[model samples]
Target: MKFLIAIALLSLSSCAVHHHHHYPDAPQTSAEPEYGNTDELYADEQDYVDDDEEPDSPAVAYPEDMPEEEAEPTTHQPEYPQYEPEETRTANQPKVPSVLQNCDVENFETGWIVAKCGSAELFVQTGPAARGSYYELSNFAATYATMVTNQETAYWGKRSAISVNGARGESTEYQFRAMKPGLFGGGTVDKDGEIIAHGIFTTAKTQHGKAGMLCLTYGSADKASCQRYFNALGKDLKELGRKNGPVMVGGVALRSEGKCHFLRPRELACSNGSLTWQGGSRQALENLVETTIAKWTDDHGIAGFYNPHLVTKCTIAGQTSTCHEVRFQGVMSTPAEIRHATLLEHQSLAVMCTYSTQESAPPPCTKFFGKS
Candidate 1:
């Protein structure tokens, strides 16, 4: 067995030695060439040219066999542009006139003089006097007397004798006569005897008119005084004119002690610290009046006015004489006007009346003639 093992080992060693000798460094193969060349391989015909031929500076010859690419030009544009705001005012534009500012009816000394013309037609005239001015008293009396007599014969009423003080001049005693019959019943007085209704009627008429004048005088002195006077007058007038219901005509007289011009009385209804009025529809003028009154009502305690049928009329004291003849006209009812009316009524009680202008103009004799 040992002899056989020795023969096998000798055979394996001879086989390993023969295998190593047969490898022979694995038959050598050549390597591949590099991508880019560092030196020039061929000389050009121009390189050999003499002075007669132009000498070439290191010519960068592009390969004629390769494809060519073109360069494109670029354009730049701004992302945003600047602009200016439009001006509201223009050189050729007509300047708008500033309208009169709204006045608070409640702020003034207010009094209502109402006469029942009948159930369907009741005449109401509320007068507002300037603060601390006695002139309004005369206005109240005149207006009350005028309203009472202006009605048709059917609604006509007469005034009876009643004592009046502080009338034309200083306090004086005077008797008042009714121009028509009383609407409060107990009518038809005998021609020989003085009417019983005159006492109460004249007292109410005078008191209603006087309250406005007194309020103006007292109110002008101070705001507190005005407020007190207004409260008192309101209580008194309300008590005296209690027969008249919710609806009443209201008037406002702007009397300037320094000037004689007479301005038409404006209608302003007062409730809950607000005053308002309706305007005519001739032009966009109606909007101006509405907005003006609204702004006044909003800023002050006064409310605003709205009525489609009511129109506003203006007459300077000297410009016209037919003050009572000019019927007050206002804007016709439109959807917007109706809407405003609804809002005003819903928000608070609004006093509404037609705005009338006087026909006769006051003579421009003195600045204080007819104004105050």
Candidate 2:
């Protein structure tokens, strides 16, 4: 048994030495079967990773001779870029000027005023003052212009003049006919006394014989913009006058002079004397006056009005009309009593309000409905 085991060991030793000496190296080939070349395979895998992003996991160990059936392409997901918050992105941006924030309508035939604002241009027009006629105001403006431009004439060579008798009903129009090119005739000043806008003005009379003044102004001297505005003047003024169609409030036909020249149209605020008017198509409560008070207080930016109590509730021309007596305690002025009237019809609401500080007299809320 010992001799047989020693013979078997010698045979195994001989086989091992023979196998080590006679075994052939791997055959060289032009094409690697998937991953035959370790250096070339690692380079191909590295190409998949983005230059900016590192792989999240450790480098994979690929077999030098991986089977073709098991081989697959490495996929490296590209990292997405991170962004700052919107507020952070805009932190250095400038705030809008307050003059551009609100439109003020103090003197105008129409209560409607609109503003066309842009990066290079701003055009605002006050329809007409309530008391002046075209003839008087135009003459006055011409006289004022002659006086003001007297000094500028030395450099500009000619003073600006208004074409008063050209056409009676023509829209407030202006030609870029200043004696010098790029010269503005007149302009509006900001609170800081900076001339922020230049004017292209025209004067005309409304259908009611009210003088209408249209001042189309611009911050930039772009001729294309000026011509565009000149073309749109007729349509814009017509719409401002509410001549687009009749605006019936509580069955009473009311004429809008134009949007309030000073107030933004979105605010829906209009005022005449002590009375304020706000109109909307949204269905308002016929019985509830809280909505009216809340909107008025918010829109007008006045101190909160309190002690609201119903003074009158009646039907006017098939629509429910209500009047509320509300008081406004002022800081410096006398504590004024206000009368708020809400005229409600189907899907329309017209809130007309008036105030009186005179304690000896009844609140003038009743007269406001008629005037409005």
**If scored against the real structure, what TM-score would every candidate get?**
0.21, 0.38
Off by over 4 Å in 2: 1-131, 134-160, 164-196, 205-218, 221-248, 253-274, 281-308, 329-335, 359-372
The lDDT of each candidate is 0.21, 0.29
Q: Report the lDDT tens digits of candidate 2 across residue range 1-372.
A: 110001111122112100000101111111111110001121222111111111110111222333223211222113211111223323532232333333322211222333444422323223322222222233223222222221211000111334433432322232121222122332211112223234344443333223333343433445344434433433334323322222233444332222211112211112221233333323333423455455434433445533434467765556566655444443434344444556454424454444344422212234334311
Model 1: residues with Cα > 4 Å off, grouped in runs: 1-136, 142-169, 180-343, 356-372
Task: Say which candidate scores most in TM-score.
Answer: 2
Q: Model 1 misses residue 353 by how many Å? A: 3.5
Task: Write one digit per residue (lDDT tens) for candidate 1, span 1-372.
Answer: 110001111122112100000000100101111110011111222211011111110101111232322311222112211111112112222221121012212111122322221211111233222211222222223322322332211111221222223222221111122223435331221123222122111221333332322211100123243333333333344333212112121122222222221111222211111122322222333334344334323322223433323222323322321111111122323221111111122112122211112222222211111221
lDDT of 1 at 120: 13
